[model samples]
Target: MSAIFYIDQLPNRTIDHDGQAYLFFSGTAYLGIPQHPDFHQLMAESMRRYGTVFGSSRNGNVRISVYEEAESMLATRIGAESALTLSSGMMAGQVVINWLQSQHYTFVYAPKAHPALWHAPTVTLPQLAFADWTAQLPGQLSALSPGPVAILVNSLDAVCSDYYDFDWINQLPDNRPITLIVDDSHGLGVLNNGRGIWPTILQKSVDKPASVRIVGTGSLAKGMGLPGGVVFGDANAIQSIRQTAFFGACSPMPPACLDAFLRADALYAEGQERLQRNIKLAEHLLLPTGLFHQASGYPVFFTEHDALYANLLQKNILIYSFAYPTAADRANTRIVISAFHEVADIEWLAESIFG
Candidate 1:
């Protein structure tokens, strides 16, 4: 492990640490909206109009209208019938999970599902690889007799840049109600041209029985660069989530952030375009070296080289290298490409790695 370097300012394409400048490639800011001048201007303008935060609950008599407006826009973008906004993505997942708890559904978790989507002592196939889990899931679900089942999974393994396929959903027996809960914190605004996993899953589940329900939760802070989270589902699911005590009691996302998100369509489009180009370039430059594992159209790149973090630090480049979810977990060392990274920044990163 390398010594921690802290910066006083937000890291975009570069960071300054101890009087040294380094190309920065760490964080969940997939669209690079946090430090973008236009985005900052938008937020500043929104803050003036909407204030920095809305301390009231969603169920309060006085409500800010931007929540509904932004949620509506999110639903349209994600191709869901409805969407709900929360203070953070973790809260969004918890809201849905809390609501589902009362319904008496047996929970089924996919391997590597984010902790936000975890229920108490989740049931999973220990030591089972992702591919094997998917292959054997149908039989396992069938064995869980007559009760309704809720399936929890992360849309993609952010740790390894591996995307999960949902084609197996069609294979599950549909006699009983089935709920698919996906944590898309790493997917929204980064995958599927910025629309995320809903549309793709919708297509794959076309042949599934009507009893299967799909609900998605994710942080807008990642790809969208908003300071909140969201839940996407059909009208009934959103309604049920809204009715939960967790939803009624929790504070909503800042109105300024939501307002900025609503107005940043052009900014998001530009960011996505820039990010795609970066991903292509990074793949072209780095994948052939057989050092990093990358998914098509995803920004994160993963490598297992133990000394790479320290080696890159000496080269004046900073990438994410630490345990996630818990300090007990092994360190995850990877490069995160953002829309703010210029072509030369990536070239420098490549050179630093293998030069």
Candidate 2:
């Protein structure tokens, strides 16, 4: 592999090398708002108002009202009692896991939990259990020795499950005090009646027994086209986690970025109509590809390919490839369909993948 450290030298999404610009189908910027005029203007205005950087932690002089408002909006949108913003999704996961460890809790995880969840030093359950959508979740829950066990679940593909049915997941016997820590990075802004994943989970948490603690983490960089991550739950859980050493040490998000995210949230709400259209297009396109399988929430299509990494690159399509450190090498590639893609882009992608 070649050692490339900078973005400018790396392959640009649009290339003049081919004597014409071609659409790039790589990276997770599905919403295509990174360069949208409204988002751009909001970011530019924020920069002018707040300068480029905040240069302090949320606990210090850098915190802004916009940050608090955004958190509240996010919490309301996601159905959490409160929310905490972090510099990145990895930070969100790390801080949450740190809190979990401080509580002396063990984690039972699905095989597909993101690396951040697995990397946390507090994690105890070694081998992740695997199950498909049809598999009985209650059976799996019952099998676990009922102690201070917390199950780490990803929205989909983690347990080879569908949008986790709240009714089914909450069916954990009242006798068992298992916490459900979910990473809805993919599901947020794209699932749960198009209202986003966090709020749905929060509502479910509210309706469930008080003993069932629900924690959710997500990235704004994906569907929202903004950079940062959020961790949300009960105010006490959030407050407890925020007081940790790790949370205190990290720098807060830049004010301008936060402003941009606030705008992005509004735009995301408006863009839902278009998002639905794109989802339908993606499903139609993928259903014909015998190699592809449909997944609910987030316009993601899964397909198995041994040469996915090299092949997509050869076609100038950037995609996520799960390698050993990031993930166990699976014979599958996840293709994310953004609402920004044109109908032609979808057709072209289908041709490239199936032709």
lDDT of 2: 0.67
The residue pairs found clashing in candidate 2 are: 26-318, 78-198, 78-199, 79-199
lDDT of 2 by residue, 230-328 (tens): 898789889998888888888766778877777676677655656677768877876676765666545666656546646666675554445433243
Instruction: Kindly provide the TM-score of model 1 when superposed on the true structure, using C-alpha atoms.
Output: 0.97
By TM-score, who's the top model here? 1
| Every model: Cα RMSD to truth | 1.4, 3.9
Reference-based TM-score of each model:
0.97, 0.81
**Candidate 1 local Cα displacement, residue 27, angstroms:** 0.8
Error of 1 at 174 (Å): 1.8
